[model samples]
Target: MPEPPPLTNHGKTMTSVFSLLGRNENDLTAALGWTLRSSPKFLAALTGALSPAPQARTTRIDLEVSDQLGRTDLELHGADHAIVIEAKRGWLLPTVTQLETYASRCGSAPIAHLVTLSDCSPDWAQMHLPAIVGEVKVTHLPWSVVGERLASARRTSAGHERLWLDQLDIYLKEALRVVEVNNAEAYCVVISNDRPGGGGPHTYREIVEQGYYYYPYGWGRGWPAIPPNFLAFRWEGYVQRVHRVLDYEVIPSLQDRWPDIPVLSESSGDRARSDVTDRPHVLCRLGPALRMDPLPTGINYRANRLWVLLDQLYTAPTLQAAQRESQVLRGDAVADESASI
Candidate 1:
């Protein structure tokens, strides 16, 4: 097997106070609270992202408020509006009960909203979290979106505010595992395709012919938070072909994004495809398919998907070798390798 490429830092590097303070959920909540308290413009931008428009004025910002129901991560009270924010470190989804309890506190305000900030995508939240708990409207704002809003607000800011925004942006990306920008150190996702034992709408022929691959978009689904730069098709007990990801789209259905492609479902059994066909999917348009040496399947591989460093995928002789190389690159121990993927 050929040697793997050397790992190098690709994106902008910056120092963040949050990074020094042990970046966790509490730190994230505190940083967000501070940002809101320090900058009214940022607060307005955040409020605008939520439904029912921006609040007139933010009267108070509180962190880690404990009550009979549960401890709310952060709370923002404004004239006629109350916004409760629950911050999770990574892709952790907020429980319905926890959200409902937070919603209970918002009853006093004329306009109430519950927002959840996490690395999980909006589509995942929509599929998992309830839209409304009682009267208060529920919204899941991905940290990526929050970072974008803050960056936008920072462009017009100056001095300490702009500096803080820059730090916060870096912190959010590093700490919260927000959408990863494509770079030289990009990875490839190896996806399972339909076969005799595996049942799905996407057969090997369909994917090769269509010039695209898709994964169901939701929490616990195999889709990556950010689309990988490359995709490897794992079928027939080996990785048959690899393709560069030209572009991607998240859509409710195949026809919704590509009207020409017929909506397809499994021909046998329960027709499981029907259950997911109407739901959101991440469709990745591919560049020319590149056939590779058949990388043999390995035991302990992830059920439907696995992540491999692009260089490793190209050079490693076996699936397990690629996974091991990726694990080393990610600094994950043998036991924790699967968990990280």
Candidate 2:
């Protein structure tokens, strides 16, 4: 249990809530970046083709194959130079025998691997592998930190905190598991939170100006000043409308009208479309002291929206608008921030 926040404002995480705990590596891996679904073929292809660069730039190969017996749990294609993976959140540790079986079939020169949602000590795995597969690598990914980060973001953003929470619940309860093996160095890369002209007049414009990857709905890379991904709008509802054209500003009126409105989710879709479903939307803004203070109840309210309100909205206009407002001026707000709307 975390202690109540200190009045002195150190702004540190309440260490009690983050003490030593058992972990699942696969979940964390998926939470950090990708979610592998569909078939073993898809997981393998995603790993085989994922680009090492910050900007993704590669066409992935498909490694699904069928055997005379039935659908092969894993597949590899020789010409494509790819590997396939099959997942079972059930096992304590995944085995190399699984990898060798796929390698033997594909006859590809590239190294093949196995991924699992659960894991054991590497020593336990070494104890079980047979000669034919002993050398084949088996990557055991745990979902601990990745899940925690995604969950925390969902529960804390100002814009769509509720929706993000909902989306997060879906992720937690689902049968989903992913394996993100990279030839490139892998890290959970969140952009530097300090962006100029961040929090805008209509949204969390001020905080976004500083460096804090956060916002109402979990949009964009959220630099605390503004949203991470785009200007605040989702397909189902107006994200930042004043409380009531009849009365309040978009943020407050939205709450007055529909207290049940959902928060946002920070996750994205395969197409990289900005309008991913269940991303957050606004409910209401909070007082300044509450807004900046870590572990504030309202912070969770906003974080909920980022991922929950991942619905698609028109991207072109919003992108255009964000650019016009933030470019080339030493604004009371950040310059070059207009490109973000």
lDDT of each: 0.72, 0.32
- Residues 1-341, model 1: lDDT tens digits: 99655433344333576565557799888888888787777888888897786547989899999987889999988778888999986556789988888888786787788999987779868978988998788999988788888978998998878777877787777775433545423334444444312443555457655787766666334457556777777665677777777866566665575454444444545755523455566777888877678778664455446667767766888777877887787898755445543
Residues forming the 10-long window of minimal summed lDDT in candidate 2: 241-250
In model 2, which runs have C-alpha deviations exceeding 4 angstroms? 1-58, 61-64, 69-81, 92-98, 119-123, 130-135, 143-169, 173-341
lDDT of 2 by residue, 106-196 (tens): 3543444444334222333354544235344444444342344445545444444444344444544442322211111111111222222
Clashes of each: 0, 106
Clash count, candidate 2: 106
Which candidate's lDDT is highest?
A: 1
Alpha-carbon RMSD, each predicted model: 7.6, 20.9
Model 1: lowest-lDDT 10 consecutive positions: 191-200
